[model samples]
Target chain A: MAEALNKAGSYFIGLVRVIVMRILIAEDDLDSQTLLKVILQKEGHEIVTADNGLAAWEKFQQEDIHLLITDWVMPEMSGLDLCKKIRAQKTSEAVYIIMVTAKEEKQDLITAIDAGANDYITKPYDKGELIARVRSGERMVSLEQELINKNKEIYSEKEKSEQLLLSIFPRFIVERLKQGEVVADSCPDVTVLFADINNFANIFSRKEPVELVEILGQLFSVFDRLVSAHGLEKIKTIGDTYMAVGGIRKIRRL
Target chain B: MDSNEKEKIVVSVDPDFEEIIPGFLEHRREDIKKILEALDGNDFEGIRIIGHTMKGVGGGYGFDAISDIGRFIEAAAKENRPEDIRQHTEELASYIDRVEVVYE
Candidate 1:
């Protein structure tokens, strides 16, 4: 059963990972453009081709491109220039760029890296190497997406925990608790009220435990709402009793 | 060789080449024209641009010859060698003219 559950869990994760990305290939040469499109399409990625950096930039603006595989040199703009422009954009998601070039100089590689390309592939590229680099870019893009999702999850969980904390204590007290402050205070102008359900033992003996608890729950909820409506702080509910404090001023009355 | 005999450089590419090769060939033709124009004007920058693009893009499409010429032209342009640039451009033009793409 445990093995089956683990398998099901992994299957669900795989289902979630079936996100097909739109990848843009910016290469001026026909042969390279065709080669990239064919290889990436085979990997189940939607391919968009551009003959120059300018065209690639235009496509990026018009479409939601998740990955870019760009050559270094073109007519209107270089791939390095494109990468810099993309990095400068204030986008919510990061666009992964893989620079494919025949420039094997160490300085050229450094320049590509500095321009914000996530990865690089050299020319006379082996098919396996090109695919692997693209896969690496995909992994980086997906990992960033996963981090954003995790951040949202964390934010929601924090909000939920705050709500739970608010349910247990007054807002001021909760804030004080968060700040690690002790909250024992003497308020002179406070009115403490305590009330208990009358003839409780007789009612409990006549009703089933579940029914008795349900009645008590309903009764306490009404009392709690009434206390809140009157700007009173409900201190605690002890079995059949409800305790509240009103006019809880920190300073004494003049 | 006659015009018919001169068109025998056949290159076999993947099946999807049909959709791209026509447009690619057209682009290459344009590049050759531009290179000639640049050579006439002694525009080393223009020649370098074409050469750089070719260097980056040629080999991936199964045209290593174009890539080699591109590399030579790029280097020659950087050194401002007009004769070398012209020679490399002619070689690239020759390759493009004779090369035939066969989709597998």
Candidate 2:
């Protein structure tokens, strides 16, 4: 009895925790909208319906939509218009939009593509074709999302790796290498300036860790400003020390 | 595919909003259900992972309300509270139910 009760309770709990992906469907045709709702529902996907392009755009703004399947034409606005609107949003993330239209003219395809429709499907679509298309969209969208996420991760990792590399070597060396410079070639009479904070250990011991961090941050900021102002290159920072190099420009003094 | 209708079909500047509302609402329901199920399974880990993933993409697709709920769910899951886990899950469902998507 206890085991059965626990199992039932767990199942109930499980039912409550299901994660659903939202989909927005914008079709002006009543029959098409109904058909889509039934189809998506059969697939265990929740569906939001819009009869016109404007309404779809509204629902798109107000809802949590993962994918959008829209018709090409309707009253007020068209699928192309909605797609353009979505793409125009300043902070807009990519929305998977599939434009289902009756018009398949070459010019029509071009216009849809220009308006930012992710894919185009013609009307009188086979049920199998429709499902395949939707799944294809799902796969492509998931893949596209995966790519976007991976790219973001790669970018951040690259940025962090760059920062770590910067900490280990001189910026000039890093930049030179980045700009395809070779270590085999040596520039003559390079002036290097290494500055260490005075009594850094004593000052650090007397201050809070936060205060020390703030002080160090302020100090580095000043160093950066000075280096940029004097047209010098910052090599690296080690503990409380800052290093720079100049004299590449034929200056007489250090 | 009416040929007569094709000739008169001149695209307009301001699109119709009513036509798309039902479809959007229906889709929102489907999405929220999946997320909730993942949460109810004591898959707080899944909830955190999926919620965080959804939060990043929700804004792009114009689903700010869902994104907001996702953000809260992610926060609650990260804090690792059983009560919070349950609370945020319920809140997420409620938001899914009540959210009104609009354009402008």
Candidate 3:
């Protein structure tokens, strides 16, 4: 039973992990197109094919493409042009591009890199090498997505911590504390208010400890809101007594 | 076919080559015809297009010789050298005619 349960759990996790990437292949030759499609499909990537660079650019605009494999020469536009155009687009996600061509000259490689190709593969490309390069591209694309998710998580954590800090202190005081500044201040013009709950001993004597504490809690919360509405800074709550201050502080010049 | 002729043109590729070799050879033959017509018409631009296409597609299908010849033709066309382009086209045609595919 335990073994079967484990199998079922893994199967469910596998179902949730279906991150099949969308890859665009722009090769004019039918044979080369078929070869690339077959290889990438076998690796579980969804393929979108175009016969020329112009068509490839169109498909890229229409779809959420994760990767591109393009031949250098085509009818309408060359692969280098397509690479430049794709790079110029203001897309939110980075599209990994691999230029596949027969040109193996160092200058050709430099041109491809300068035109914004992330990687280059020369023909006749070895099947294993092609797959390995594509796998590397996949790793890079996924790493970028992982970094984006981590950043979002960090932002959310920061917001939560800020909320917790705000609950403990006033906003200005929290800012000063964050800046590592001393919080001592002498206010020349200020109003200090203090309030104490009356008949506190009599109320405590009549009620259970828990009930009395609950009552005090509700009463103090009301006072806290009132202090904030009146634009006053709450200093501290000492048992039944509440203290707050409103002031302008002047720095003493040495 | 003669053993010498067969040995002259060889395609060393993976098993997937079997599925595409026939079509690839047919395409090369068509490209040869186009190259000849472009040469006869002195249409250097047309020749360059065909050469560029071959250069891109030939080696991909285990025909590095075709890619080399195509590169020569493309460069000659860019320079508008009819004699050099014709010579490269002749070499390309002979290479295609003598070619044989061997799957690894």
- Model 3, A61-89: lDDT tens digits are 99889899999888799999999999888
Better of 1 and 2 by DockQ: 1
**What local lDDT does model 2 show for residue B42?**
67
> Candidate 2, what DockQ?
0.02
TM-scores for every predicted model: 0.72, 0.49, 0.69
lDDT score at residue A99, model 3, on the 0-100 scale: 93
Error of 2 at B42 (Å): 65
Error of 2 at A226 (Å): 4.4
- Model 1: lDDT equals 0.81
TM-score winner, 2 or 3: 3
Residues B1-104, candidate 1: write the lDDT tens digits: 76667757888876645676677667778888898898889898888877887776676666777778888998998899988987887787788788888888
Write model 2 residue lDDT over A94-159, tens digit each, in one string: 467788765647899889989988788765454566677777776666565567768888999988
Error of 3 at A35 (Å): 3.5
Instruction: Write the number of the candidate with greater lDDT, choosing between 2 and 3.
Output: 3
Candidate ranking under TM-score, highest first, comes to 1, 3, 2
Of the candidates shown, which would achieve the greatest DockQ relative to the real structure? 1
